[model samples]
Target: MSDVFEKVMDLAKRRGFIWPTSECYGAVAGFIDYGPLGAMMKRRVENIWRDFYVIQEGCYEIECPTIAQEAVFIASGHVKGFSDKMCQCPHCKEFLRADHVAEAGGIKNPSTMKNEELAAAIASCTCAACEEVLGTVEVFNFNLMFQTTIGPGSQRVGYLRPETAQGMFVDFSRLLRFYRDKLPFGAVQIGKAYRNEISPRQGMIRLREFTQAEAEIFVHPDEKNHHPSFKRYADYTMPLLTYVQQEKCEEAVPMSMQEAVDKGVIANEYLAYYVALTHHLLVTIGIKPGRLRFRQHLPDERAHYATDCWDAEIRSERFGWVETVGLADRTDYDLKAHAQQSGTPMTVFIQYDEPKKVARRRIIPNMSVLGKQYRNKAKAIFEALANATPTAEGADVEADGEKIHIPADLFEVRDEIVDIRGEDIVPHVIEPSYGIDRMCYAVLEQSYDEDTADGEARTVMRFPPNVAPIQVAVFPLMTRDELDTIAHEIARSLHKAGILAEYDDSGAIGRRYRRQDEIGTPFAITVDYDTKDDQTVTIRDRDSMKQVRIAIDKLPSTVCALLDGSLKFTSLES
Candidate 1:
């Protein structure tokens, strides 16, 4: 077992965050139940994500159904291609992730290997389960989607959507019309995504069903370089892992967004802009700077649909530098595929400023004449003509699969005056997808430490205010009625003001503070007898163990300002 992971798991259960599901009957793998604290923490993290990508970024947040029809996956190429290789343990008959097992045994790029090669790799290896030599290992594809029947009959096949971006793709036309035919627009969906792992041995880092916050930004293919808000984050510095740097085995180099794009560490301004945003959001949400890096996805590891992909990987004691977020440039492949399969025009019409007159050859169909000649098929001929490009006709026309033998008497072929106003184009998508479960674990693991305070080793979680499960804990000095009353009142005030505050009075003041600190409450407000005299409370900084006095009336704003970093506890009275 990973020792650090085991420690965090115990801390999570004891502190009211996350625990295995159905513990009474026997715990289940790949499923975890969030406790009161965990649920609150998850919501808080998602809300902050909304602020960054949805609100500040000027995108729409949509809620879509979790169960999608099989056609959706077929159109999105998941039904055919979304698969992971699997191998079973011979002795125990337990299945394991094929590539992971091969890679752990020194096969460099197991994902790119063929089934025969995979089998060969496993043959020379011993199963981790029973240490028995794997014999004639079989490598087979396993679809990771969790399938379900939609209705009464088991006929209709449905699946838990593997991603949130597909809903956005399928809803593109409605959104386009709603936005009044805008060229560049974005849509986001934050919800659950599922992948049935064969074995989820890595604690919270891997889950069968997990929360995913994803953004899909659609733009004209040629216009991806000219992001309007590119300048806002151009100067922001980040740890960039350029493709070239990897070739030299160099460490991730710190550089500005401008340099990252200019140096080709990031593909373009649009991609760089979002990568910078991801970095900012991670840091703002309590991930330490040194523990985070942006790694370029090696070619074999990139999603099949992505042209360029990078991930925001965070370092954890349990899993070293795991991928918590993915930033990918999925160029118009999805839309094109859907458009072709569904027989719907997916391109947006980009209108020109002024209509242009162009001379082009046309099959001038006489409606009155052709209508009489082929009365029923006249409209069909016109449709075929409209869809047929000049080159397709080649001075002859095929109307509705009927070869139209053009004769001078039947129709006239000549250059005609026409107005061309706009052209249709498929919009390319850039996506930033995040895994909330992995990130939550990264936060807990990175912030965890055991420090000796007064000759006692104390475990504490140092979460930042924005994403911390509990922001502050309101503690009364003693269990006396008056102190408890004041503490309860103060806690109520904080709750009303949207602060997560806890009212604890049963334990000693020091013990209470320690308890709150253990769960990563940044500030603790202790109501004492001094509050009765001066009506001022003592606010203690959890990390520094320093205390200051503040008026009771100023508590809300003072705490609010401190939480946002606009004011410091040292500068303020508390």
Candidate 2:
């Protein structure tokens, strides 16, 4: 870990934000426990995401079981493809990611290499930790899912979900019904997803189990370019690093959503819209705009099922550009896969704006002749023949799970004019997947700051008021009963008004202010001698360290305004 990482983690642990999980037993890597403050901050982050995806985007959220049947992954292709290439070092007897090892040895784009290719690239490399020459490193696939049995004796195989997206895909038929068979509808899931990482050493960046907030917007395949809310982000400009630019190692250039879509840089408006929204969300949560970029995933790096993918990456001092969100255009892959595997119709009936008369081929089955000829199997054969759409030569009919070829005489095809009102289509999905833990880590890393105040070095977390763990801190100027009573009362009043306030009387007023500042408390209320003369207290701003005295009666409203950005701290003092 870097010095900045250590400093931020030290402050995080000391101030009750986060700590390693199960430290009492010498905790293992990649797991963390959010302390009280960290929990509060996490809730704020999740709620903000909900407001954006669920409320503003009008996507209905759903909670699903984390443990799904093996069939779910089998259809989603996770069973066969969700794996990381691994190799074991002969000298150190340690396992490592083959691509990561190859990349560390200065091999470019090692992740795109085949297993045999990756093995050859890293064969001459040495173990990073043991410094021993790695010999005969055979690369193999290591699945990242946590496998388990749903019932006794491993009768029903189950695994923890790798992403929240599959749940939405699996529930497509139900969600379609809920939306009344609408073509452009979305479902979101925010819950725990598990990946049994091979080696998780990057603090909160990689985890065996983490939270994912994923939204799957199912739209008609032909309508991806036509989002009803596209106007909201059409003019929003952000730095976009296209896949072509990435191949040449070029920087991201600023481009508006409309231009990106028109120039075919982005696949569609739906994908570009979510990309912009993710950028806005990251900035709102305190990530510096200059340190953030939307990097388009190269074909070799993107999932095979995804047509286009972009990662919202934040530049961290320790870990470079860390990806926090993924916006992908998964073109009907999920629904079609599940539909084929499960034999469930995962399609939406899209109603056309106007009913149109169209030329069509109609098949008429000869049931009476088939019944007499087929005997006992006649009904099944007739039913199959009736449902079959005939070609010029013949038609394929299915009966009792078996396909049978029916002759031209069994079914007759005729051209007819029919009124077609709608069509059934497997909707394409636009997913904006978030790594909640990584996001929290980024927020903390970016918010961590240090400066000199009153000739003393002080560490401060410059978290935004809306997401900060504590909005206000109440303190008594001195350990006097009169001032303590006033401070406690003021804290109670603030709490009643739905403000998170902390009361401190153990240290000097400056120490109290510093303590609150370190935890990102936006405002601090201190009760002093003047409180006895008149009901008033001093409010100190965490960022500016400026003080303003306001009446006790006006404290709640004034502080509420400050927290919400409706009333500025500077304006209050002036």
Candidate 3:
């Protein structure tokens, strides 16, 4: 781990941000427990995501069970394709991801290699644990889904979902109805997803169970080039690393969403809009803009469902650029796959501006001849034939588990003109999936800073005012009755104003300030003797360490404005 990562993680554990799960016993890898402050910050991140996706973009949010029937994933293609290359160490008998091991052993693009190629590449790799030479290790595919039986019997199969997206896709018909059968709509799911990792080495970055906040926007396939709110981020500029740039080994360049769409770097307006929105969300949640970039997925790197995808990667000191969010254009793949597998029609009816007369050949079954020849089976044959498309010579219809060819004499084709009002089409999905745990870790790492305060080294987490776990900390100048009472009152006022405030009277005022700073509290309110004489208190900014005294009555609004970025601390009168 890098020095910054270690420092941030140490601060996180000591200050109640996050720690290993089941630590009293031997803790397992790939799992963690969020501490109090960590939970609050995570929820705040989720709420901010909801504000952007649900409230601002007008997308409906839904929650589904983490465990789903096997068929759901079978339709989504997770059963056959959601896997990673795995190889077991000969001496240690420990399993590890083959591609990761190959990459660690100086192989380039190991993930795209074939199984044979990967085995050959990782032949010289050593075990990460025992350091035993892995000579000619056998590499095979390992499914990542956590499989289990749903009922008492093992006959019924189920698995924990690897993503929240499949649930949204499975509920497409209901969501389509919820949106009044509209062509353009979205549904968001924020919950836990599980992936059985071969070996999770990264602390919080690669967890077996993690939170995902995903939004699946369904739009007409032909309308992908146009989004109703595309203008919201059309001119928003951000760093983008296209596939061509990656091939050429070039750095990411600043480009507007509009320019990316026009240059075909981004697939469409809908995808570009969401990519820009993801950028805004990451920055809003304390991710440094300078350390964030949107990188397009190379052809071989995209998922089976995604036609075009971009990953929002945050540069961490430990992990160079970790992907926290995926913006993908999954063109009608999910809904279509589910519909075909489940025999359900997942389509949206789009009405035409005007009804038009269309000409087509209609198949009419000859019931009289079919009744004489087959009797009871004749009716089934007629129904099947009526729905079947007729060829030049005949029509093929399945009835009674038998394929019967109806010759031109048995079925009649008529050219008819019919008035068509609308058509049903499977809507394409543009998904923005977020790894919440990774985002939280990134926020902690990026916000970490060390500097001198009052001639002493101070470690602080400079979280954004809105994203901070505690918006303000109320501290008493001293452990005095009057000061404590005033501090409690101020904390209560801030709480009633819907602001998170922590009250501290355990130690000296400086110690309390440092405590809050370690946890990324944006502002600290000190109720001193001046507050007793005049109904005013001093508020210190966490970043600038600047103090401003204002009337106690104006405290709530002042803090609210400051937290909301409507008021600047530097502009405040001291």
Candidate 4:
């Protein structure tokens, strides 16, 4: 780990941000427990995400169970495809991800390699634990899903969802009805997703169980190039590292959403719009824009369902560039898979502006001649023949898993002109899947800073005002009866105004300010002697340490405006 990562983690654990789970009984590697402040900050991040996707974009939010039936995943291809290459260490018997080991051993893009290729790459690699050379170690695919039984015994199989996108796909019918059978609509889910990692060494970056906030936007397959809200992000420009540039070892270039689509860099407007939205959302949640870029997925690395994909990568001291959000154009893959597996029609009816007369072919079965040839099976053959399109010679149909051939005399084909008003189509999906845990870690790493304050070295987390866990910290200069009472009253008033305020009067005033600074509280209110005499107190900004005296009556509104970025600290009267 980098020194900065270690320092930030130490602060996180020391202060009640996050810590290992089951610490007293030897904590697990891939599990963590968030402290009070950490939980608050995580919720703030989620709420901000909700505001962007659900409220602003008008996507309906839905919650689904973490564990789903085996069929749910079988249809989604998770049972067969959701896996990682693993190789066991010869000396220590430790199972490690083969791709990670290959990458560490100077192999590039190890994840796209087949098992045999990965085994060859791991042949010369040494075990991270025992330091023994792998020497032709056997690499095998290991399924990552955590399997379980839904009801009793092992009769009904179930597994923890590896991604939240499946639930929205499974509930497509209901969501379609909710949106009144619209062509374009979105459903979002924010919940826990699980993956049984072989070896999770990146602390919070790689977890067995983590939170996910995903939005699955269903749109007409033909309308991908024209999203209704594309104008909102059409002119917005951001750094994009296209696959073509990546292959040539080129850097990301700033490109507008419209230009990316027009140049065929991004597949369509829907995909580019979400990529731009993801950028804005990450920046809003305190991720530094300079440290963020959207990288297009290489063809070999893209998911099986996606035609085009981009990952919002954030630069980190320890993990170079980590993928926090993935935006992909999953074109009707999920719905079609489920529909075929469940024997349900997952389609929407789109009405044409004007009804048109079209030529259609009709097949008529001659049952009277079929009854003599096959007595009991004639009706079945006739029914099957009615649905099959026959060539000039004959028609072939399947009945009870048996392919039956119908001679030209047994069926007749006729062409007819019919008026068609509408057609049913399977909608494509544009998904923005977020790794919430990675995002939280990114927020922490990017917000960490150390500098001199009051001629003393101090550590601080420079969280954005709206994204801070506590918006303001209330303090009394001393631990006196009158000071404590006034501070409590001020805290209560701020709370009533929906501002998260913490009242502190325990230690020295300087120490209290340092505590709030470390926790990323943007403002600190001190109720001192002046407040008792003149009904006014001092408010200190966390970033600049500048103080401004304001009446107690104006504290809530002032703090609200400051937190919302309407009022600037430098503009306040001193």
Candidate 5:
């Protein structure tokens, strides 16, 4: 591991952020335990995300099971699909993802090749892991999803879901009913998705099981061409790495969201609009705005069914531009697939204002003349013309590229007027899928920093106040009788005000402040001796360490304001 990764691991472990799973005996490769502080931070982050995608956007949130049935996967095309080309080491008997190995080794499309082709590619390349001459790497398709049996006897085969998108697709009909059968509404799901990693060694970056926050927005096919809410993010700047830019420019280009949509880089207004919103939300969640960019997937890398796709890539200290979120225009693929498989209609009844009238074409074959000429085949010709609509060949169209010659005993062909009602349509889907675990790590990496002052360096997590694990750290300066009692009382008061206040009296005031700072607690409230007479406590800022004296009665509003960002520590410092 690199020095920075080691530091991150050490800091995370020491500060109750993250740890390996089942360390009592042996640790699991693809599992992690979120410590007390880490759990709070993660929960707060997810809640804030909900505030944006669910509450603000008027979308409903859904929870689904981790293990899905084989039918669900088959319908979603995950059974035959959802695979990565993998090669196993002969000596160590370890499996490896072909794409990762080829990319790190500076090769291209290693997974797309056949077994023989991949075997040839590997002969020229060496394994970074063992440095042992890597054997012939036969490219075998390996499903990333972890398989499990739903019932007791392993009779029913199920697999842990690879993505949360399928859940939203499966529940489309119910969601449509719940939303009063409206188009252009979204269903969001935030939960765990699993992947069985092969030879995992990227720390928390690549995990077998991770959390995902996914949104499936269904809209009419024509509606996707333009979004009414596009103006909301029109002026926002998004650093874009398009296919053309990647090929031509040395770095990503920063432009308004509207410009990208108009220039055809984003494909449409709806895709661009959400890309900008995602950009704004990421910055709000403590991901550094500079290290973030929306990278468009190339034609070869894009999903076969996607109309357009982009990834929110966060530059990690170690991994260099890792994909944290995916925004794709699925365009009625999932629903269509399910409809075909289940033989059930998954459509909303869109009511039109008025019925339409139009001139129609009808083919009426002349059966009177055919009855005298060829009476045997007269019925067949009449049936064929009645069932046939207008084609290039007019009446009695060709079957299998060959004309079925019939006698003229059928009805005649003519145009007739007809009145038409509304038609049913398959709503296209625009999905914004997020890898929540990766975003959590990005927030940590971006907010992490070291400050040096007074001949010593202090490490602090400069997390946003709302998402910080501990909102306040209550401390007694001397751990004295009066100070300690008042401090505990003050902690209780903060807790009642809905703040995550932690009481620390075992160490010096500075040490207590340091501990709080490590976990990204925004404020430190100190109840000193003067509180006994004047009823005042000192409120210290985490970032600046500036202290302010406030009355006990006013402490709640002051701290609450600080937490809500309505009031700032700098404003109250003086």
Candidate 6:
């Protein structure tokens, strides 16, 4: 960790934002507990995300078990491919990611290298902790899933889920039924996901267990270029770093969503719409617009199943640009894989706008000639040929792992026109995956500020009002009964009005305000001697440190309005 990271973490710990878990027993890496303020702030962030995906998008949310059967991951491809390259130090016996070691040694893009290349790079570099001349470096795949047993004696294998996406895929049939087997319906899941990191560093940026908010929007494969609500976000402009620009070492160019889709910069309208929504969400949650951009994933970097993918990267002082969310056009991969593995159809019946006659191929099988050639198997072959589309010359069919070839005289093929109403199709999925822990860290870092107040350096977190840990803080000018009583009353009133408020009366007014400023409390109400007579209190703004006097009855409404940006502190100057 760098000096800036240490400072931010120190303030977080001191102000009840976060703490290392199991500190008394020598805390482990990659894990931390959210303190009182952090927990409340995290809840608010989750709720805000829910508003965007669930309420605004009209998607239903579902809760699933964090642990799943091994078969679930096998179908999702997480069991085999979800791994990282790692090398254990011969001297210290500590395991570390091989790519990270190569990057520290001035090698760029080590993630795309093969295991042998990563091993060779590790051999040239020394241990990061100890400068020991390492022996031969052997890079190997390290699976990141936490394995467990569902029953006694390990009969049923299970694992802690690596993402919430698989849960949505597994519940496809149920969700399809809920949506009445319609296309373009979505399901979202927010829950804990576990990753067994080889070497977890970077505080909150990397974690063994974290929260993920994932939504899978199932749409017709042919309808990706057109959406019902494309106009809603078509005009929104964002900074886009295309794959071509990355190859040329150029910065992101500002472009509107409509232009991006029209020029084929983005894959389709569905992907572009979510990209714009991600920008809106990040900015609304207090991320600086200048420090955020959408970087398109290169063909080599994207998953095999995804046609196009982009990451919403947030700039951090300590860790350069970090990916907080991933939006991908996963076209019919998960659903098809699960259907093949589970033997349950995962498809939506898409009806045509108008029923019409379609050309059909009919196969007529000769049963009498086949009955004498293969007495028992002829029956199965006749049934198989009935459902198969035979050619004019011949056709091949397989049953019970045996290949059976039918002669040209055995079956006749003819084309005919028939009326068809609809057909079943595997819906393509557009996913927006979010790492809540990383987002929380980005919020903290972006909101952090340092300034001099009254000749002393004061640290403050200028978090947005919607996601602030404490919306308002109530303070007493002094620790007197007359002042403390009014402060508590004001706190209660604010709480009743659905505002999170804290009351402080232990120290001087300056110290109380400083404490709230550090935790990003937007508004502070200080009850002084004047309040007992006039029934008015002084409200201080965290960002400006400006104070305003308002009547007691109007305090709740004023604070609420200020938090929502409807009422400004400068408006009360006159």
In the predicted model 2, the residue pairs found to clash are none
For residue 167, what is the lDDT in candidate 1?
93
The superposed Cα distance between candidate 6 and the true structure at residue 325, in angstroms, equals 1.1
Model 4 lDDT per residue over 1-574, tens place:
4578898899899999899999999999889999988999999999999999999999989999999999999999999789878899988899888988998899999888888988987899988888889887889988999988877566899999999999999999999999999879999999999999877988799999999999999999999999998999999999999999999999999999999999999999999999999999999998989999999999999998999999999999989999999999999999999999988889999999998899988888777788888788887787788789788889999876789888898878988999899999999999999999999999999999999987999889999998789999999897785998999999999999999999888889999999999999999999999898899999998989989899999999999999988998999953
Model 2 Cα lDDT, one tens digit per residue, 313-350: 99989899999999999999988999999999987777
lDDT of 3 by residue, 1-574 (tens): 4599898998899889898899999789999999999999999999999999999999989999999999999999999789878999988899888988987889999988899999988888888878887997889989999999977767899999999999999998889988888879999999999999877978999999999999999999999999998999999999899999999999899999999999998999999999999999998988879999899999999988899999999999888999999999999899989999999999988889998899987777777887898898898898888788878888888999999888888878898999899999989999999999999999999899989988999888999887788899998898785898999999999999999988989877788888888888999999999898999999999988889899999999999999988998999953
Residue 179, candidate 5: C-alpha displacement in angstroms: 1.4
Q: What residue runs in model 2 are displaced by over 4 Å at the alpha carbon?
A: 84-141, 359-366, 376-416
lDDT of 1 by residue, 455-531 (tens): 87777888777777888889888878598999899999999988878888876788888888888888999988989
User: Could you tally the backbone clashes for each prediction?
Assistant: 0, 0, 0, 0, 10, 0
1-574 per-residue lDDT for model 5 (tens digits):
4556677778888888888988898999988899988888889889988999988898889998888898888999887668877777665666777666677767787656776777677765666666666767677788877888877887899999988888988888899889998788999999998988766777788888889999999998888867878888888887788977776755788889889888888988888888988998888888878889899988788886697999999998888999988999999999999888878778876766787787976766665776666576556655566677645444454444446655333445567777667677899988898888788888888778789746779888889888789998888877776789888888898889888889989877778888888878888888777777798889988888789998988888888999888998887765
lDDT of each: 0.85, 0.89, 0.91, 0.92, 0.82, 0.90
Clashing pairs in 6: none
Locate the minimum summed-lDDT window of 10 residues in model 2. 383-392
Residue by residue across 1-574, what tens digits does model 6's lDDT show?
4566788889888888889998899988988999999999898889899999999999899999999999999999988779778898988987877888888888889888898878876787888767785568889888899989997787899999999999899999999999988888999999999999867999999999999999999999999999889999999998899999999999899999999999999999999999999999989899999999999999899986798999999998889999999999999999999999999999888777888799987887777887888788887887788787556668788756689888889878878998788888999999999999888998998888899999999989999998899999998888785788888888998899999899888767798889888899998898989998899989888989999899999998999899887988899877
Query: How do the predictions measure up, each by TM-score?
Result: 0.87, 0.87, 0.88, 0.88, 0.85, 0.87
Where does candidate 6 stray beyond 4 Å?
84-141, 359-375, 387-417
| Candidate numbers, best lDDT first, in rank order | 4, 3, 6, 2, 1, 5
Q: List the residue pairs that clash in candidate 1.
A: none
Candidate 5: C-alpha RMSD to true structure equals: 5.3
Give the higher-TM-score candidate: 3 or 6: 3
For candidate 3, the TM-score is 0.88
